[model samples]
Target chain A: MTALIAFDWGTSSLRAARLDERGQVLEERSSTDGILQVPAGGFPAVFERITQGWPLHGATCLASGMVGSRQGWREAPYCPCPAGAAELADHVLWLDDVPGGARVGLVPGLSAREAGVPDVMRGEEVQVFGALQRLDTDHGLFVLPGTHSKWVRVAGGRITGFSTFMTGEVYAALRQHTILARTMAEGAQDNTAFLRGVQHALRAGSLLHGAFSARALSLFGELTEAAGGSYLSGLVIGEELRAQRLQNSALQPVLIGSPALTRRYALALSVLGVQARELGAEATWQGLWSLAQTLDTTA
Target chain B: MTALIAFDWGTSSLRAARLDERGQVLEERSSTDGILQVPAGGFPAVFERITQGWPLHGATCLASGMVGSRQGWREAPYCPCPAGAAELADHVLWLDDVPGGARVGLVPGLSAREAGVPDVMRGEEVQVFGALQRLDTDHGLFVLPGTHSKWVRVAGGRITGFSTFMTGEVYAALRQHTILARTMAEGAQDNTAFLRGVQHALRAGSLLHGAFSARALSLFGELTEAAGGSYLSGLVIGEELRAQRLQNSALQPVLIGSPALTRRYALALSVLGVQARELGAEATWQGLWSLAQTLDTTA
Candidate 1:
């Protein structure tokens, strides 16, 4: 039974999920060849290559993330919030004649504007909505960690507001490009050091003071290259956690991402005396299907 | 006669000044060949190239900044603070034999230990002491801007403590390397946009959120590339200033650096209702000479 094809394409990678009406991932294919790497032959050709024999014949194709960005296949306009699957389905853009007159729909990105200066997320909105569907709960703090980690607030199955933290991006930039790189050992992951980093977040100070400590600890022989790097990671993640707590102390942020990344966030949260639960991959798959269902009804 | 040979050799550049007993700059030369660029031929050869025919024979040579860092000419250990030129003079590293038996001295940098993690600065201590000597004041905040800007506490002619902000480095990284780079117009340094950034810093939020505004503003047609770049610069500088205020709102930090930078910092300070003054180049020369005077007296 062919329902639709979904994707979670982004800046660094691309992925496709074949799904049925029950919102289950029938089969999945992915590659590092993201929007950034797609050739001059364009996105349709790439999509066709990956979706070969996946029942594109009259299949409803849907895309999310940067694939809907200006740099991607087609510029799917961002739908400003307060929005959920209904608003998302209402604003999706579709591609015509995508190799077989197949209709390719793009889930619009969501923008938060209540505080004035606008902050936005493209694919994460789907993830948030998916969490809403999976948890069968209305209100929760969804933290989707990545290069740009998001802290989103949801109420009545719609996103009220959210904030983006440049933790992962800062980590990558500092690790590879800054003077602190001298003190870090590549490919080293130390959990104790990581916990120490989470603990350091309890101290009152700016990120600047905390970051320099990576080298200070290494110079003092108190932290090794691996541990120092881990501590640096903790400092960044810790800051993100602290910012959200400062904003709303009562809200417990629910983690949603891969097992590896979200585990670190969960560990950091536990260290801060906050219990965070992880959502499985099924959430996004479910979210995409829900939106597709909305598309079916709305269309 | 050449009373002293002074060099401010830091990470990115090397500068030389021949000073008389009165601390007047008789001759000056500089190059981009900082410690990081110096080859296996080493600091001595590079030093000789920059200081050729400058009465190296039996001259009292002195160096400060990263030249004395672990990767510099020779590692000069840092002097823990609550001390000034006198304490700095007491721990100078000396070179006995060179092209001539010139007694070359390396001024020790200062380290702050009150904050559990040790923070250090190599060259700015001289500038701080120099500001003290030139201003005839004992207590004030000294700001030296660079890739890592330093804010030092000076009281009773002693450098009590200081903190380093990675404002400039973060700006460079974001403008050149991050996703925000695409939204920014290269070679754009608008004062208006810069001020808007400084003003935005007053609003409550973390740096991650603040930085993303540069892109959001761009995406929404609210910010131009040039203005966006300046705004990014402002955000970084603004965060540093805000952190200091958060720590203690009463101190008026004195600015030291190139006129262009101090001027911008001054503008931002004024926007925030704080007045800051600039220290002239003579202050650093006077500071290096002042420390050398202490060395002479101690010797």
Candidate 2:
């Protein structure tokens, strides 16, 4: 029998799960000390504090996210894709200087060249792998949407390639800082405006032309402040579709994220005459778990 | 001798200049209570507080910028192009009830509809008109670089049309809020990086393609953090050129605003194979003054 701990460390929070031999989470704990908040040199101590008294006398710790960044404990070099579980497992960096003598394994991020564009993915690789484990097909597109959204193509349990969009971050900035902020109505409601905006972008046929039209529509009272968010969402997603069209249009997409975000992606994909399937949150969590299983088998 | 007071009420500050019959400034006063800070119903008191004892017992008050916006004391309806000083003077709105009993004349903002794109200019309209007064040419592009940078085309002393670019605000947000902020070195020291960025953007051929290159170049070490600002500056300026290329290309542009901004614009324009002439700040102020002159002559 063996024990292990898996961590998903992001910008805002650090979440760790204690897993048993069967790859089931025994106990889960999270901390506020994410990459952004924790001191650069304090990663080791912070990790120790989180995993304290978790019965880890002889267990390997698998970590991901900003923890593997340049500012993290030690830079785990990126494993460029078409990378699989074995490649990720082989590239895991082991820390020798932990206080409690715990062996630490850091998951390697993926980097790949697509259409002459070099793209990189960190935590999402594990999640993509996790989602692939739950699927029957070997080939499909997987999307992870957040601050920096990613669209990945997976085949045979390996990440073939991916693309990242500054959609969420741009949306946040536009809604809070730019003139578009004034047009945004208070409170979160249904994405009626979002759908409308997507349709508008589709009709406009270009992101640049569609984006400026948001301001024009607002100025002309065609779109209200409450609907500005939807309009912007449409503009960005529409732009993504246009860019993708310039690249290739054969493959369909599967979205992996929170329900709300996945729905938005689905709506955008639907507008472009593409079908998208939602990968449940549990599937993503399981995707990471599957990577942990691979590590266990290797050990 | 007729007396006039020109008030430039923007988002952050208010400036009032008392002028003589020849449009020479007799006195100037300013306040921090600008349109953004003032309450919706507090313009009268704010105006009274700033313009107190300006010897405007019978002087005409010519106001511009956000002060003539919808939230201002009175809405100065937007006048469509080709707008002229007479149109602005005739359409000027007045404060119906004022404690000081001053003859307030709010300058009407200029608006235009061309190629299905509608644009408007308020405070800058006065400045553009003022700049035109000193120019002998009947047609040229007038560049006003600010929070919402306006690239205006004028002919025959009338405002023909203009395009707005959100360059300054984008710079501020990117520097203060985004991941690019962390990578960008503090303070701008060299125009070398900025100018180089402009050249790269001009070469990339499209604004969107050029923008992504900023990130790619930084990652590839072709761009340094210290030069990120320049890269950004180049991207925006490049995008402006791409947008402009779709419009007219023959007319040389007249650069307006501060020395630094004009210099940057001049450099970008040169990179895009366009020759530009530097116009002075006095033009915008003088444009407002000229509008006041027209009001006086016609009244």
Q: Whose lDDT is greatest here?
A: 1
lDDT of 2 by residue, A115-137 (tens): 44455667898887777777766
Clashing pairs in 2: A130-A287, A183-A225, A185-A225, A185-A226, B127-B284, B130-B287
Which residue pairs overlap in candidate 1's backbone? B185-B225
**Candidate 2 chain A worst ten-residue window by lDDT:** A201-210
> Model 2 scores what on Cα lDDT?
0.73
Candidate 1, residue B242: CA error in Å? Answer: 1.8
Kindly provide the TM-score of model 1 when superposed on the true structure, using C-alpha atoms: 0.94
Residues B15-129 of candidate 2 have per-residue lDDT tens digits of 8887777778777888888787998789888888888766657667878887887767678888878877887778888776765778887787777665554566678888788
Docking quality category of candidate 2 according to DockQ thresholds: incorrect
lDDT of 2 at A182: 74
Q: What interface Cα RMSD is found for model 1?
A: 1.3
The clash number for model 2 is: 6
Question: What TM-score does the predicted chain A of each candidate obtain versus native chain A?
Answer: 0.95, 0.91
